[model samples]
Target: MRCAARRCAGRRRRRRARGGRWRRPRRRARAEEGRGLVRGSSTPVRGAVLLYGLLAVGAVTWVLADRGTIDLWRHPEPLWRFPFAAGLAGGLVVGVVFGRIVAWLSRWAVRRTRWGAGLHEEFHALLGPLPDSDILLLAFLSAAAEECFFRGALQPTVGLVAASLMFGGMHLPVNKRFIVWTIEATVLGFALGALFWAGGQLAAPVAAHFTINYENLHFVRRYRPA
Candidate 1:
């Protein structure tokens, strides 16, 4: 009887150990699931905020432009000098090419450096798992609003270099990667500013901005880890 009782106790211990092993994984899965839910729920709110903020900026820009508060075209080229169609086409090409080059460089840096990799991951985390349609709309709105304000209104007043620097500075959130992001934004601003200066209209910079944003977002959505 004593031997039988000892054997039963050993079996019970073994069963508990086995149960614990299974329960740990289940608990971890539940925790991960909960986190995912939280992230998913917050993405729309972020998107909405971004959309509205861009819209407000665009509205202000439009009002200023209408009121002659800002000169979008300082040089005031003849209509024949920078034809809308030609400007749009050239801007599209430049944007696509520049965007691809930047994307390639980013991929290379991510692979080669820990800092690059971390920044890449951080960006993905901030974006979360937004739907493709929402991302597309966000991209469009961002391009339109930003170009209207930055290239259209601010660039003419501040000059290209100052405007580009200001654009970069605007991106410098109080974060670990503030410098890196600011530098990146500065470089992009230079490109867009050049487009605006060359084309002497909002169409060029807007087209370029839209193309770059659309491509970059799509790339992130498609290539980022599940």
Candidate 2:
């Protein structure tokens, strides 16, 4: 009778152990789910701050450098009267080519899949609707600031690749957004860099960037939903 009682006790103990193990998983799962919620909820705000902050910092740095107070040593160049004009022409050519390629890729991709759809939606959300003045201001500021930073100072000393990476890095850390966008921005950065390097004038890339942005803004405003 004692042996049978001990066997019953063993069975009860095993049941209790199994119940405890199962209960643990439930608590762990709840904790994991809560963590996911917190991460997901905070990602967007964090990403925006990161991206916008980088751009703003880069702009401020460029502005300070331009004023000669921050004088980060850059390659000295002989002043040429025609550098501005040359840069303007060369920048336009490069901008047109790059713009066409981007547009074609966007068109080809947008019709085919969910990824394209999401890209389209995101693109529209970020830059689809704006007034003429807003477009002009955005184009001007972006052209002036980006050209000054990437093409003017960084590209001359660091080479095209480093400048490109810096430009891309400055646009970083979007929520679950692939680094591919950063790379793409880098390539665009390089193109502008090349324009400045080849033309030997900051004005060229700035003009080109402004023109490209204006066209892009116009196209999106016309075709995409707000």
Over 50-102, each residue of candidate 2 has an lDDT whose tens digit, in order, gives 54447557645764665554432222352333444564566567666765666
Native-to-model Cα distance after best TM-score fit, residue 75 in candidate 1, in Å: 6.8
TM-score of 1: 0.67
List ranges where model 1 is wrong by over 4 Å: 1-80, 224-226
lDDT of 1 at 1: 100
Error of 2 at 146 (Å): 0.9
lDDT (tens digit, per residue) of candidate 1 on 25-129: 999866544442224435653655566477556646664765555444322542335566776676677666766666677676667777676666676777755
User: lDDT for every model?
Assistant: 0.67, 0.61
